[model samples]
Target: MDGDLVVDGNITDVDDGAAALIVLGNLRARNIYLAGDAKLVVHGHVTAETFVGDMTDKLVMIHGDLRATVSIFWNEFCPDLVAGTLHGRTLAPAYLDLSTAPIGCLADPAPEAPLSRLLAPELLVTGAPGPDDLTEIGIRGDALRDRLLGGLPLTTTP
Candidate 1:
């Protein structure tokens, strides 16, 4: 049933059970998600954006081909990730400006990311530190997304 959909703003498809939303185009919204086993596939770029409840949302790179220059966050004063394979500039780790709402990632490592992708590219921690646990957030756009999306080759530094 070609159930995939592409949109540009505030995507909400909680109606369907366990659905996948493909963002092949540009999108900007305060919140975007699917209610049932929902997964978000970011294709291009997301700038000055935010997403809530990404931990349980099953976020991952649908096709390893495409890369994004988007900066998205779960909270205002949280570390925003410029998700993509390219490198050059870095997202500010100290997001004190987002004082209104504690960024989801800033609180604790997202447990879903067992692979620890959040600490891989960078680590942004808030408040005092003492054996804290934060779930890992990730741009699971591995080599798979690159081939499917037919995007530029990714470069990772070790």
Candidate 2:
């Protein structure tokens, strides 16, 4: 639960039924699969190094930040953010359920620089020059993941 938790195999705890697998430290895994109704609750943070098993699994919830280097294909990607931040290099806007995903804060025109960097850039898009009814943008999750991995933070600039 401390250092790096390298899970080279599979994490299948789909029968827990809402139970939380809380981790005190960071988690480094290659492939993760959450089935049934179990919830993967991490207190520190999770770093999926290799690849995520699936993205449709919404049972994986993190209290801390999540850093992934690969593309996570999901029907919808919306993490239950408590106090931590989101750092996916390429998790694009198109994969987000804007209706439920908290992309940007309308309250703050420009969010804090530090906090913005820790989160995905795709979450900052509003109404661009496109379809008026456009709800999602086609952005790559790996791109955002790379930026976060490369230590590039999201910025508010023209």
Candidate 3:
């Protein structure tokens, strides 16, 4: 994009053939979901509620700071380069390359579970929620993950 991009909802890339994106300015979004091979580069800062990068060969490079409530990198091959500071909770594979280590952040190594398993339903409902909200519903983790991986929206009207 030529200038700053603001997304009210989410930015999801599930297609394997998705095109690469280059943002000249900052990017503000609710969430970012990447499960494709396309590369994403942001020259300016990136502000989001959550960022989920599943199994993919994409490289995400941010020239400026990245501020989010939660950032999850599920695959070791997914390389994320952040030139500036990173602020938030980061759940990533130990081998993943995040150029700059986060500051005063809670970093967690992703478990053997799928990407969706790390995301709680409350996150989709509310931008940020308490950790205990994960079990507030009756759905199993695996089941929820499967549904999410299958392209089902977590929060939708019947």
> Which numbered prediction scores highest in TM-score against the true structure?
3
lDDT of each: 0.33, 0.44, 0.60
**What residue runs in model 3 are displaced by over 4 Å at the alpha carbon?**
95-158
TM-score each candidate.
Answer: 0.30, 0.45, 0.62
Error of 2 at 72 (Å): 1.5
* Model 1 per-residue lDDT at 2: 36
Looking at model 2, report the run of 10 residues with the lowest lDDT sum.
Answer: 103-112
Q: Which of 1 and 3 is the better model by TM-score?
A: 3
Error of 1 at 76 (Å): 19
lDDT of 1 by residue, 31-136 (tens): 3333334556655543322232222334444232212222323222222222433211222224434333322222212233322232223233334432422223
Cα lDDT tens digits, model 2, 4-50, are: 46665445453534566667666766434443455666666676532
lDDT score of residue 103 within candidate 3: 30
